[model samples]
Target: MDGTREMKDSKQLISNIQAQYPRLSKGQKLIAQYILSNYDKVAFMTACKLGETVGVSESTVVRFANALGYSGYPKLQDALQELIKNRLTTVQRVEMANEYSDDTTILNKVLKSDIDNIRGTLEEVDEKAFEEASNKLLNARKIYILGMRSSFTVAQYLGFYLDIILDSVHIIRMDMGDAFEQIVRINENDVVVAISFPRYSKKSFEVVSYAKEKGAHVISLTDSIFAPVASIADNVLLVKSNMASFVDSLVPALSISNALIISVGMKEKEEIKEHFDDLEKIWKMYSVYE
Candidate 1:
C-alpha cells in the first residue's frame, strides 16, 4: 500500500471557513489566508505570533478559530500540527531513504523512528479521545474497518487482531461498490474505523461518509484534523506520519495500530484469551503451527 492512500481527508474546518466565509472582516481575512497558506507554520505559532504576522489581534485569532468550529486558538493550532505531521515533503522522503542506506541502518532507523513516533503520539494523542474510541470498538455490536492501499494494512491488521481479541470485526478491502454494500448493514450498533493519511484516498473518504450517514460510529486514524474523515468521526486518532517525499513512513502508523490492538485486548482480556485458545485449536487442526 502506498503512503498517500492513508490520508483520510482535509478536515480543517477553520481554513475551509476562511475560504467560504461569506462576510469576513479584513482582519479575519488576513488571519484566514495566513492559516490556510501556512498551516504548518501556524501549528507552531503562538496566537501573538500569528497575529503579528497577520496583523490581527490575538482575540481575533481566537475568534477565527471559533468561527471555523474549533473551541479556540489552541484547537486551531493543534489541528495545524496534526495536518503537518501527516503531510510529507519531497526533501524529507529523500532524507529518510538516504538515512536507510543499509539493512542495519534501515532496521535501526525504522525501529527508532517507530519508537519516536509512539512517544510523540502519546504526547499529542488525547487520552479521553482514545478511551472513547476504545470503548466504541469494545462495545459495538459490529466493527467495520475501511482502509485503502497502504492504509489497508493498518485496517486489516486492526480487524484481524481485534477478531482475535474481541468479536465481530470485519475488514472491508473490496472496491467501493462492495464497501457500500457492506456499509448498508451498519447501524447505530456498528462502528467504522477509517484509516487514511496524506494524499488521502477518495474511496476511503467516501466510505467513511457513507458509514456516518448510516449512523455507525466512526473511529478515524489519519494525519490531519483537516482530513475529510475527521469531521465525520465520532473519535479521531491523529497519527503522525512524517514523510520525506511522496512516500510516507509507516512505522508510526503501525505503532498506533499495535497500541490500539493492545488496548482493545486489555479491555477484553478474558474474551481474547478464550478466542486465542479456540484459534490455537484451529491452527493445530490445520497443522499450521509455525
Candidate 2:
C-alpha cells in the first residue's frame, strides 16, 4: 500500500483515559492511576500482570481497554507503548533495563521476546510493499541507504549486502558532511531506502522529504505506520523491533533485511555466483582468512 495514511495520534490514549476516568469501574480507576504514574512498566506488562498489579481480575483489565475505545487489550497496550517509546530518557531506559536484572532467566526472557517480535513482523508485514521495494531496488539507477543512531546498523547491513549484488548501491554517511549532500544527486530513477525506529532521527524525515521532492522512490523500513518516515514513503515495510531492555530488539529489523536481500539476490543468482567465485579466488590469493 502507498504510505499516505494519516498518522494516528498516540496522545489520544491519554485524553481517552481522562474523559473516561470518572465513569470507569472502581478497579479500572486503579488501572488508570498506575498507568499515569508508571506507563513505562505498564507498556511492557501483560493484561493479567496489569490486573494483578492494579488489584483487579484479568477480565477487568480487558474491560478497561475496551472502555478506552480499544477493541482489545493488545491494542490498548500498543497505544501505551507508542506514547512512551520516544519520550523515554537515558536514565528511564536504564531503569527499564533494571526491571529484569533480578531475574535468573533473563537470557530466556530476552530471546523469547525477540522471537515474539519476529513473529509479529511476519504476521503484519505488507507483502505488496515488500515486492514493490524489491523491484524498485533492482531497477533504480542508484540506491541511497539512510539511517542514524542505532538504526545505522540496519542500514549498514543492508547496504553491505546490496552493494555486493548491485553495483549502484551507496550508503549515505553523516561524517562526510550533511546527510543531504550525499543524496543531492538523487533523481526519478533512483531509490532511497531509509530506516528509522522509535527515538527516530529527525534527519531521516528531512532527507527523505528532499529525496521524494526530487522524484526518487522512497522505501521506509520502520516499526509503525505512524512513523514520520512512513508517511512520505512510496513503500512502507513494517517490522516489530519491540523493546528487550533499554534498547529495541533489532532481530526483526535484520530479519526483514535478510529477506529483502535474498529476494533481490536470487533474481541475479547467476551473476552473483560468478562475482562471489572471483572474490573467493582473490581472498584465497591474498590469504585474507586462515
Candidate 3:
C-alpha cells in the first residue's frame, strides 16, 4: 500500500474494524467490540489489560492488531489514541474518569491531564496561523461569532470583549429560530470566528459552511485538523481539550481567545481608549460602579 494511503487507512480505525469485522475470529471479534465501544480506555490500555478486559489471552490482543494491518499491538494502540484525541464524547470521557476513580490521587491526575493538554496545545500551535487570525479580526468590516452547546460560552466571551473595541460584532445565537438568517448579510468584507470542541455541534458546521458560501473569511478554533470546521476555515487555531471527566477543558481555548482579543485591542489602542473613556463617563454618571 502507498504510504499516504496507509496513513489515511490507519486514521480510520473504526471504519477499518467494521469492514474487517465479518472475517475476524470469535476472540478477535470480542476484542473489536470492546475497542469500538470503549476506545477512550483502550487507547491508554496495555495489551495485557485489554485482553483481560475482553476475556481473551494477552497473545490474542497482539494477533488482533496484526489482523488489522498494524506491525504490532503498540502501532494499533497509537492509531486508536490518534482517533480519539479530539473526537471523544463526554460519555467516553466520563468512562475514562471512572477508570481513575479508585486511585487515591484522582484529583491530581485529572489536573495533570489538563496541564498536559495546555502544554501540548502551546507546543503545537502555528505562529503564522495565529497572526493571520488576529489580523483578519482586526481588519474585517464586520465580525460574527458562532458556537453552540459547550462552545457557546467561549464564543460569548470572545464577542463580549471584541464588542467593546470593535464595531459591528455579532454573536449568532442558535435559539434565534433560523441561525443562518443571522448571517445572510455576511459578505467578503466580514469575518466569522467559529469555536467547536469534541462531539462538535452540527449547527456550528452549518454556520461555517454558510459563511464560506457568502465569501466571508472564517477563523476556526477547534481541537484538531480533523475537525469539520478546520477543513473549511481560512484560519484554524488548534487547542487541545482532552480531559479526565465528562467535561471538556476550556483553559487552552480561553487562552487562545484571550490572545486574539488582546492582539486586536493593541492594534486599535487609540480606538479602544476612546471607547473606554466614554464608557467610564456613563458608569460614573449612572453610579454603576463603586
Q: Compute the lDDT of residue 170 as modeled in candidate 1.
A: 85
Q: How accurate is candidate 3 locally (lDDT)?
A: 0.85
Name the 10 consecutive residues with the lowest summed lDDT in model 1.
Answer: 1-10
TM-score of every prediction relative to native: 0.65, 0.91, 0.76
Q: Cα RMSD to native, each candidate?
A: 8.9, 2.8, 5.3
Model number with the top TM-score:
2
For model 1, residues 165-192, the per-residue Cα lDDT tens digits are 7768888968545778877788989999
Worst 10 residues of 3 by lDDT: 1-10
Candidate 3 lDDT tens digits, 1-290: 43224335657889999999999999999999999898878887879989999999999999999898886786686567667766666666776766675666777776776787788689767789999999999999999999899899999999999999899999988787688889889999999999998787887898899899999999999976778898999998988776657787898999899999999999999999989999999999999999
lDDT for each residue of candidate 2 in 1-290, tens digit (9 for 90 to 100): 11121125456778778889999999999999999888878888989989888889999999998787676787777777777887788678777775476566678778888998998789779999999999999888999999898899999999999999998999888887998888888899999999999888888899999999999999999988878999999999988877747788888999999999999999889999999999999999999989
Output the lDDT of residue 110, model 2.
87
Candidate 2: minimum summed lDDT over ten consecutive residues — where? 1-10
**What is the lDDT of every predicted structure here?**
0.74, 0.87, 0.85
Question: What lDDT would candidate 2 get against the real structure?
Answer: 0.87
lDDT of 1 at 130: 87
